[model samples]
Target: MSSMTKIADIEAEIARTQKNKATMAHLCALKARLAQLKRDLIASETKKGGPKGDGFDVQKTGDARIGFIGFPSVGKSTLLNKMTDTFSEVAAYEFTTLTCVPGIVAYRGAKLQMLDLPGIIEGAKDGKGRGRQVIAVARTCSLILIVLDVAKPLQHKLIIERELDGFGIRLNQEPPNIVLKKKDRGGMNIASTCPLTQLDADTIKTILSEYRINNCDIMFKGDYNADQLIDVIEGNRVYIPAVYVLNKIDQISIEELDIVARIPHNCPISAHHDWNLDGLLECIWDHLNFVRLYTKPRGQVPDYNEPVILKKTPQPTVESFCSRIHRQMMKKFKYAWVWGSSVKHQPQRVGKDHLLDDEDVLQIVKKV
Candidate 1:
């Protein structure tokens, strides 16, 4: 039978069992099984490039992708809708979002794309209720945003952390920023004792600096031991750089906000109230090391006055940088003229083998 028809039948059975405890238990179990089947169907459809399924291929488009992850009903969808132009369904129910929704958030004339993935549940990695599928989506993203309900119990928060671990999605590297939702709700003050909140900024900076210097050009080939893997990917390289955004600040008190602010790298905001969005945007850019660079006309003299951001990458060769501008630029079979600290002459021409450094300006003269 069709999924809709099956759901209808299950609903009818559930309604009929309202007075019978034994029948209700059986129907509820069946309903849960049916829901799992529905989720599997959705996952299969998405993998095959169908409309009903979430478009996973959207990430391959070279957009700076961010993934949203957390347990059910943590306001991830609400934050996604507020940050991007997407109209994702926002409800208090768990697992309301089954498919990933990709949306674009424009900031300061640049567009950053983010993905709102399905909610993760306990034991998600081992084929538990859309857990495996969600982890697959998270693997492809450049950044992961881990949303947490601050009002929820500590045990609940730890459940999410364990789920991430179960899926082998590393949070410490490209580690997801903890977005503490419902900060306004009066609850047990978890922020003060939060392990993440207790992290010192200076210590974080020191660790990041050491990480950059040591692993600047290191590349892993095949599967290594877990100890080696941990040593290699535990820092910023494997993990997308992240900044904490304490969402739902309008619901919290000043004292609470102050405690949250004291956290090493927290940015408070109210996604529902549309507060501090710009600050969040700025933080995202800063964390991502994203720089805006405008293109200039071929014949027109290059403007040295306007600043163009040259993003730092493990490999910043001419070939890689040129490909970013346009694949055709690389295919056109021409050399690039480098102008900056590397060359003494004005607009010094360099071959395709040239390596570009941060803030180095270039004028590519292609062979049409």
Candidate 2:
């Protein structure tokens, strides 16, 4: 029998055996067999790719991909190393990380992929010192983290800012979160005294009004905390998410930690000391807004526990996501069985337009 037929038989048997105490154990065994069959069917279909399950599920890509950019020696490599298990060379000297290194940051049960691009300096977009390559990397990333060395002179910051503007990469809707690294260096604490959270509206406007952002359609992967900055960079329409890491905190005092906390949408961590790293990961997961769900054949009661993560900015529809599972599934899709927050009653069939909320189990039925 086809998978659908087997599911229907199981459901019918479950109803008939619901009141028979002597057969309850057998009924449960049948249910387990039905669940396994459904799983096997889904796996086979998914393997077909594109609608047919030939490896076309978009959810397989994991959470959003984010890119990191900043001036050399701003602790970008160190932060990346701490957040992800991958070891990119972390040196005290400038320009240590020459290429982009991608790593996964696990947060609150979700995994967010972060990319550490080569350090960018003033005039990078104009092909000065690998600026072109950095810009190329930025173009493909869903979100960009601009690392700033607060210990450096104001002139250095301006040079980096001017180069970004010169490259026409400043998305004016949301400004990048400026991560101040090495706060303990030379006993300098610029951000501590002049907190980013304390910046007035005029100051923020003046800071971002110059750049002529060229790419408007790019989508960045980050947590919701970065909404403000992403909106500024992408013209208020695009949602770019990011998490701010105040690295080298071990060298600083509790007073410094308090100051870092005060900064808007910031997470403090000491890569060397491994302090508050879990908190940072939690923040990253919250930012991504990911949800988990499971799929099975129609007419079979849905399983709630075995779910796969589906990364989405906002929740998507069952039909739309079914297409992501397999292109052929989309073509043959007749209806869906849904279970979640949006469903008002017991498991039931839904039309193609039925919207799906987070953690909503789905069993898509298609006509052969």
Candidate 3:
């Protein structure tokens, strides 16, 4: 059978199989097998020269990137045009925006690059409708704006999410706290800090065996399922925040809008009519989790016109801040005086490793 056929058969079996202690090992092995098959298929496609055409090579710009992903003509282009004031050629027909269109949105003193990617279709992860190319760009984004038509929001949302999930994009999720280290002589030692509720030793061993991992030390800090463990083993998954942009809200009633708004991490807006666009921008800002830092010169006041934007993840430090300003700034740096919630005292003296909070004023004191 073909790889796709095998994958389909495995999925069918996995779905039909009942959940119980007796079948957990079997289910885990099947999932691992399915993952390996997909990996092989991707590798083969890569060898055959994957999608690289159609102006998909968008230059990374601005502080961070937010990608608009959905089915064709779902107001992605319109939303991009409205938010960034960049023309993406919106139309009523499908597939109007073919290439990756990049636009910059200046919000709250930070510039965010917004990408209007080509619409993705079903089986996108399998390279349908230039889906791989679109998803490839989406993976680079710090946040994914899953634009959906408010009429059929849930239906399209599920399909688009499936596509992204298949491509190893875990939206609004943290990486599984499972570590697998390969050692020559360990002979497959498995340990867990918490109780293994979703996984057992048998299931874990089955999954590991499918990967041909003979000797390794595996540590599970949380009760993760088989798929999460597989993802951990794959080590290529990206945890990105996402917001479901339910566009064309003008067509829906207030009751419908109220129901749609109840969905977690969603924003209802009318891209064509420019309604609730502010709410969408606010949602984007919240999901981006950006840290703004102001630079205070030696004698002058802190420059608030333009603040340094940093990702809230990895928790920005003084050393990183110095590096952001200039590579050589750290060389002449002695210490910094920070004024923010991160410091106990007002404008406390701190070293390079001190972690900075949002809206912090930093004044670097270089060695004389």
Best by the lDDT measure: 3
- On the 0 to 100 scale, the lDDT of residue 91 in model 3 is 74
* lDDT by candidate, in order shown: 0.59, 0.57, 0.91
Candidate with the greatest TM-score versus the true structure:
3
Off by over 4 Å in 2: 1-62, 105-111, 148-239, 297-314
Candidate 2 residue 27 Cα shift, in angstroms, is 77
Which 10-residue span in candidate 2 carries the lowest summed lDDT?
51-60
Per-residue lDDT of 310-353 in model 2, one digit per residue for the tens? 55645677766776676677788888877778689757679888
lDDT per residue for candidate 3 within 198-308, as digits (tens), equals 887878888998998989999999989999999998888899999999999889899988987777899888989999899998989999999999999988999998999
Question: Using TM-score as the measure, what is the rank order of every candidate, best first?
Answer: 3, 1, 2
- TM-scores of the models, in the order given: 0.59, 0.57, 0.96
Tell me the TM-score of model 3: 0.96
List runs of model 1 lying over 4 Å from the truth: 1-59, 108-110, 152-157, 172-238, 261-265, 301-311, 326-335, 338-360
In model 3, where do residues sit more than 4 Å from their true spots? none
